[model samples]
Target: MSTNFTYFADMSRKGIFSGHIQAMVYDRSKPFNSLPLLPPTGIEEDVDILKKLVSSSRALASVDGKVQRLPNPSMLVNTISLQEAKASSEIENIFTTEDELYKAVSDTIQEGQASPSTKEVLRYRESLWEGYRRIQEKGTIDLDGIVAIFSKIKNTSGGIRPPHSLTVIRRGQSEFRAGEIIYTPPRGPGIVEHLMANLLDYLSDKVDPNTDPLLKMCISHYQFEAIHPFPDGNGRSGRILNLLYLVNKGLLNHPILYLSKYIIVHKDDYYHHLAGVTQAGKWKPWILYILDAVEQTAKLTNQLITNILEQMESTLEHGRETIKWYTKEINELLFSQPYLKPKLVGDRLKIASRTTLNKYFSELQAAGMLAQIKDGREVFYINRDLVKILEG
Candidate 1:
């Protein structure tokens, strides 16, 4: 059925933002088919498309350890690379429900999300941990593990898998239609489940595990998203799948390259490219996008790591006089985890005394090499200057 789509506006009179529109679907039996309530004029520039390309390219280049001039001479290549990075990172960073959701995801993925939080937090934590475990033990992809992991996130226990009736709304102010699928995931009763098992086997064994890791990752990501196997948490599942896929393929030593940031920023384009392939028989854009994200994220992540190392080196060099071996050791440790406690310091550095660890931490803080977090209990030592550089 044909649907009319329009945009919305904010209080400030700014045009309806992309990804922020309300859509109503009229049944074919009714007089109207659909109407997309849209906002007014969006921000425009003489060089909007190019400007977007520029921003995306700059972001992409920045991720890959290169900070290009704001407006570059090589518009064509930059635009291409920007699209690539934008596609990949969008897939990498799936948005959570809120700040709590973000922390839950961050903690679950980076650390472990085990403390008291929402049901979503618990599920995300369990799912992420399960993915990590599968990577560690089998170095193989496991659909059942993924299903079970998401089952926990959905707060359903004693089920073979999540039910297909679950619904989700991806767009703001847009409700789901009866026939339209906001997020109707696949059912794993028998036929669908069997297909999934086979798909995983093919992904695991289609090629020699030791070869063309990046290409393997791309193929696996496409295959998993196509399968759309779970009733809930598919987006999160897909993201985790990408990282674990890389780890199993040995592309990344750890799940540190959270490409989600890139994706989250270019979320609209990301879904567009994915839908383009599904609806318009397009694949190159998606593939190139994935490749660009990988290359850019890897380079950007590597740069972050390098910057952290360099900052550590410089800090240690400058503070060598006042700081002890424990100080340097703690600095390196903090670089690895970004957040730590005095207990972790004592345990990691083999400092038998908490007082000694605290002493070292205090001296480092005084030296402006470390800072505490919002949490009162945890005083996280940070390389402020390096942190700023990475954040920028």
Candidate 2:
């Protein structure tokens, strides 16, 4: 459906625009003190948004349902959350390899030995889990919860940016207009808080109760990025907030949707749509892009989960048929993560006898279920199939 320019016209009357309504102009170099508030009218009635919303909601619900059926949902949570953390960080140009991430998670290397980028990525995962727990306990998302997320992500005790901080979103060094200001967030005393309070109210349905939760997510995401409350890590924090918002609205049981992968794939379009909202008040393209991200990521995640489950079943069948020491407990432990250490396996399985533990590993390796890797004195088994699915 098509929405007239009334929303922008109303916003202009409210002082959101710096020039005539026809031009819809605003200065990008200055703090955007007049940024419009949340719950833009007419979004719920847009035909294109509603059409995409149906498929997006269905796809998201499918993921939630499949995760609930797993014997150990936390296993999938741990794996998928890390993947999300990695991709989200990469969006900000913080890169880390899968090997480093899995190895750090498995404790095969010392914490201090992990690269700075890997540590930051781990912190992002920690922030995600912490936010999940807080939402579960509080039954609502609040300013304190958001601050906690940003703090954990950057490993700082700092809260929102003070009025003095001059923050501006800029282009990357590789871009043609590198270092040029893209958009400056709303600033000045009480301005950020005012916008954020409206955002929180919108999330709680205090602004508009009729809007669908999925649609609210799309709108709130844009508002959060536009607000840009924090000095750094706003991108990562906003991404985490997307998942938590889904869980808070009951559309997701756990944050296992893998949404960032789609964003990474369409990185340029992602930024363009975000800018469209701020510059020209183009909500349809932005909302449609987010809806498509949810739908595509949910489908990809379902397939990935299916592949992992199938691999687990195949591994169990192979072990039961070929290895004499196979057990359901061992199989589950092996699939808990892509990388497994001998000590970790022995400890979890209560196999105190080194000989017996070694035999189990030897048989699994001999059965082609696991590949042995030796790093100096450290030895670990790699679930090749599971890693491939996750990496894919």
Candidate 3:
């Protein structure tokens, strides 16, 4: 590593430089073949970094405890994962509204009703759940598993970017320097494979056994983005890997943390810190950024969970008092997802008659516990409070 205070000071003022600069030989236009391997030296020794890690770890543990204590943890997983999917996709410029996404999940939207963006967002959610499942089963994700996740996210059978693929990350189209190259990921005959292998090893603790899991996650994320292993969906795949890594390490029992929300709020800082690591060897800022994301996201998620639990309890109490047919099962079903179709409700509650199910919905709506919304010939009963909480 080299120190160029004058040069980095300018970049730092522009939010591009952080800790220190790497070798000057690094070029943005050419392939980053010299990209360093995992477990960067002295990162674990920084007192400031260690302090952030401790606070982040504590906040993350709090979220894990809150999630486990829920009677229907899968409900939180379902809602939060979809939220992550939407936020992560939005980062890539994929746009979709929360209503459309929830409608798609509720199946109230007919075939071809979901826009391409919404479908893509749903695929992200699917990929996230699948990755979490694979982590639980295998206790670790290998290169093949990584490819599988990317494949599911992209809805293609394609694997890693071959040696010939010319993938270059660039600025957004709306930016002043639109289409300008920001960084060229590693490319060569075996460079990607070798780097990916090292990343997998590091993730499995085979390379950096003493490194903290959270710190290792931040390092692996940068390396994965730098490697740019897949031809597409690398960013989304890397985000999924973040949650899965936390779960695999037992820091989280379920992949429910909405880290993407934090990234969305700090989009500029996120990219700058990533660039900090790639352009310069500034691990401290990137590490601190991710630590802040984890800690803040954990607190936000914890608050979201608290709001949801409170809403559920209040809804249950009100429904019990207002509706004659109201039961705990109905409240649980309604809160399982923000949107619900009549048939889904009937099927879940084992109500065999359409007329009876209709009455239940009507009574619930009349009691102000559910709001009715129409989409074409279909009807959806929405828990508006739940939707508001989720949208937040």
Candidate 4:
């Protein structure tokens, strides 16, 4: 049976309204503890599109398995993680070049000298790893844990915004009207607390499980965003939750899916779909939007894994045939950080001579495996193919 999800209105405190003396109110408080009536969990949604989505995600799972089988998964992991960080941050208008980001996080470089955009991206990646580790250790994402995730990303002590803060989601800044109030989130400490408690319940699977985990994730995500728990960092934190939720449900073995890349690509439609549910009680379109995101991203991810494996093998095979100093360890080391320096690889391989280091990398450059990059007085080798794959 189809059900209507109407937005509930909440009265605002006196003087809380936006400009022009209109009483400010929040009308998007659709709770998540209950009342998101999904279609029957099974055969009802088994349309051709759903079937294709299942096939696409299943194919992603298969490729994810193959990526793990590679001689070194760290190579792909580092590349994908940074790319995800870059793409996710870009959605927020924080921009940085790939070279700058890679150089910013480089162990040899000084962190203080990195551009603001680069530093933000590095923080996003670091926070993601922290969240992944937290989930792996605790096996649960509690309120405190979510706060900590935001803290790490924002580089501050992050917690839900209090009622006194007066955070309103607005568009365009105009002195006359304080911009248009797109939506005013729930206020009051007690109300926010209750909603968060319900969120924890949903995340823990303590609620009903009739809906598929994927669909539930979509609902949970909408709830979190609507809750708008934090004054800032809600978007990024919510995204981190997306990946963690997938992991919690065992949809992914590792946090390797670059789902943000897909979202950033469809940025406008992404927000529009979310807004549809908020304003018009449209659920099917939003759910299908996320399903397609996962499906398309999965297909893209699977192809990338294949490309990485093939490139790594090709590089290793070339080394085996031509280079006298070729070793699997050396090959993996290069892929591990597509930007290679002589001192770095030399330290790893115990080669004390500059000539030997240059020879090894130069041969690969000649083979089109690497391109010699000059950074001021120092020369570095860029794994051109890996860079392209990761950047794209």
Each prediction's whole-model lDDT (CA) = 0.48, 0.87, 0.86, 0.71
- Candidate of highest lDDT: 2
Residue 218 error for model 1, in Å? 2.7
lDDT of 1 by residue, 357-390 (tens): 7787787788776776653332344445644644
lDDT of 3 by residue, 153-272 (tens): 998999989988888988888997999999898886766886787788889988879899999998888888888999889999999999999889999999998999889889999999
Single out the weakest 10-residue window by summed lDDT for candidate 4.
1-10
Model 2 per-residue lDDT tens digits across residues 56-141: 99999999999998889998789889899999999999999988788778774544678999999999999999999999999999
Candidate 1: 10-residue stretch with minimal lDDT: 31-40
Cα lDDT of candidate 2 equals 0.87
77 Cα displacement, candidate 4 (Å): 1.7
Candidate 4 per-residue lDDT, tens place, 239-302, comes to 8888888777777766777888889889888888877766655666777787788778877888
| Two-way TM-score contest, 1 vs 3, winner | 3
